[model samples]
Target: MKKIFSFNNIKTLLAVLLLCMGSAACKKLIEIPNPVDRLTPKDVFKDSAGAVLAIEGVYLNFGYYELSQGAIFNGVMTMQTGLLSDELLTSSADNTFVDFANNTLRSDNNAVASVWSSAYTNLYVVNACIEGINNSTGISEKNKQQFIGELKVVRAFYYFNLINVFGPVPLIKGTDFRVNATIPRTPVNEVYQQIVADLTEARQLLQPAYPTTGRERPNLHTATALLAKVYLYQQNWSGAETMAKEVLGAGIYNLETDLNNVFVAGSKEAIWQLSTIKSQLYQTVEANDVIPMFPFMIPKYYLSTHLLDAFESKDQRKTKWTAVSTMDIDGVLTDFYYPFKYKNNTAAATPREDYMVFRLGEQYLILAEALARQGKLGEAQPYLTEVRVRSGLDEITPATQPAFLNAIMKERRTELFCEWSNRWFDLKRNGTVNEVIGAIKPEWQSTDALYPIPLGERRLNTFLEQNPGYTE
Candidate 1:
């Protein structure tokens, strides 16, 4: 098998790609030999294998890499956003973690800038792939459509996170840095519209079956699954219900009976998972960072009191997904609980877990919430109960629509905690950020509902405006 292509200098390559934009006029964009070290857009999309390899690079970015500031998809969202919300508490006094936890984020926060840059960096690659695949004549027609569809799903996912985290952001559709740098922040609603459009198109072009051997790539249902989430976030209750119900009933996945199995690589519940590139050190960055070598050792990141107290009694997630560390504190044993969702810290010959991006569990919650919001309490109860029962909790009895919605949200807090900033995004989307975060954090402010646009980015692009409540 041919090795996956590597971007020797992504910046320089992107600059070259900018001049080689795919168009009728630019048809014979300078051709170079197919060397794996260097890949031009023309060389990349010249054939089906090259097209597939180009997108694989995008997936590689999401897995464990040696970058000092980790890529956004590679557990960055879970850690930073986890701190920004109440899901996690860190022992380290890093200012980046401190700002997020205290809700006093400055424009120059290194963490914030890393996230911004990482996301756009990946987005550029995705955009380039889309352009290359579309412009390619060597690749088969079907492959081109599916590849573009997959890229759109990824692009939508990035923009969705950007919209949620930064309120408004530049929606870069192409690989031209000059144009992207000068683009102003698009409104949140407009960004959502674009996300909806991308997912909508993606759903049409993708096939139902996994494009690859594993669930590493997005399928037709994957696009639908994400569209469901997009609808849920937009409060399109009916649309959310339709999309979630389709995935839930498509017979593709199930809720893992053992909560511990839910996050394992290629688990039955995973709709989309990010495959890890095995290395000598660890299978996943999240596991290596969050899990201590010894059971009795305190972890770098542990559950916050707010999150620890949220789980109800007999909740298996509290037992199965979390672990306790008993440390000797001056002859006194102190216990600290931390997330144990990803169990493989050491690199095994075969990985036990892949970074879970989407799964059947979230779909059930989405379906239940969508139904409950539409006053279909009777219909929604079963979906919510399925998840609860799987976790060894008693099934909830029927309740009013509002009560059902509340229960669904509460269940989301416990079931999805520390996974992907679910708690933080939920707090913001549900308008409970100030109430929940403010009760715990005295530094919380209404303006903190959206993070500041990174200061360095704003300085570079004067067109980019600062989010309210941040200094220019």
Candidate 2:
């Protein structure tokens, strides 16, 4: 049989397999014939170009409507979680935003299902890439390691998000559909261990410089930055501090002096970003989703009053990162604010902004928090100061450890809001979710910290357990 090895063909194969795996009848559907004339992994990897294209296919999955820029991972989850916490509030009749903003999310929510399915679907592609790259005899050893390293980083990224959102998600590291179809949730701690291991190996395997010219591809520093965050979440302060400092010391990135330019394409602050090149439908999905085209138009969501009040009067981020408008509510003209970090929403052929996954601003906060946790308050001051000074705020001088940590948490809340689940995760990790969010949202419960596992997923796989406080 003649073997076909092409980029489009490989992408189609991966997409079909992922679609099958994401279906309710995944087991039966996934048994369908492999595309490319049932080409073995060897045949696909035999051509170095095909192997590279296979990995690029994984990146394409990152930009999928359900995954990165769309409503699931980077866009929706970030916005809704902001609403769930305190960064945003519902302004429209969309039930999904209304449900999340009101702290009344259901397991059957389509947004919830999309996040769960898309994350795993992309993860399946990552595992497939790792397996094919490792088993390929045609590829050089160096090329194999590079591909495997990048895939490991992507896998760790998905697991990190999964564990954070669902508490203990099933850790699927292999491409065995039979086993993955029924895998149960792994312990949260165990999941962190796997993340650390993957990131550590990835950091070692990747080069200091990014593999690609842009920040879209993972590098040693990219792995280090993520690993630092993993360590921070795990309370491994020394590990977190060490890894964070390594990235900073590399001199590859710097805090973008102009706060407004941080999210622009080719930013100096970007450690890892997702290119919108593959997303032809929208130039910047997160921007187009959150920001309204006209000043008076009500956006799908708006910045919460709580977040608006959190910023100091002179803080540049409030002015530079958010947009203010006045809209008629009933007969009264009311003022509203929405996140404007991504300023461009036009559907131009070349994107003006990139969805930032990791950046120097986050690293600065990560290092500061890690240092503060280790009781190095004085040492942590400079890193925190760097971010604050850039935000046009004066340096803070907290007298005590608790005060310093609180400052770091507050800084994270303001600096990272609406970018990802930064505010939500910071609140959860700092053990102030109930005290902070509950005070603002009366419906806030401790159990609300973990989103409900999608109802459809529970029905499809009997082994999957529902999160507490959600219907099984």
**lDDT top scorer:** 1
Cα-based lDDT for every prediction = 0.80, 0.79
User: Candidate 1 regions off by >4 Å?
Assistant: 1-40, 64-70, 349-351
Residue-level lDDT of model 1, residues 383-455, one tens digit each, is 9999999988999865577778889999999989987778999998999988988898898889987878888
Error of 1 at 294 (Å): 3.5
Please give, for residues 1-472, the per-residue lDDT of candidate 2 as tens digits.
0001112323434443444443332333244455545655555466566677666656655643333422244576788788888888877788877888888889988787877777877776677667777777788887777888888988898888878888999888775555666888899999988998999899779988777779988888999999999999999999999999998999878888998779878999999887765454566677777778788888777888899999999999999999977998999998889898887776573437888889999999999999999899989999999999999999989999999998998898889989779898888887988998899888877899998988888777778898899876
TM-score of each: 0.91, 0.91
**Which residues of candidate 2, in runs, are more than 4 Å off?**
1-35, 64-73, 349-351
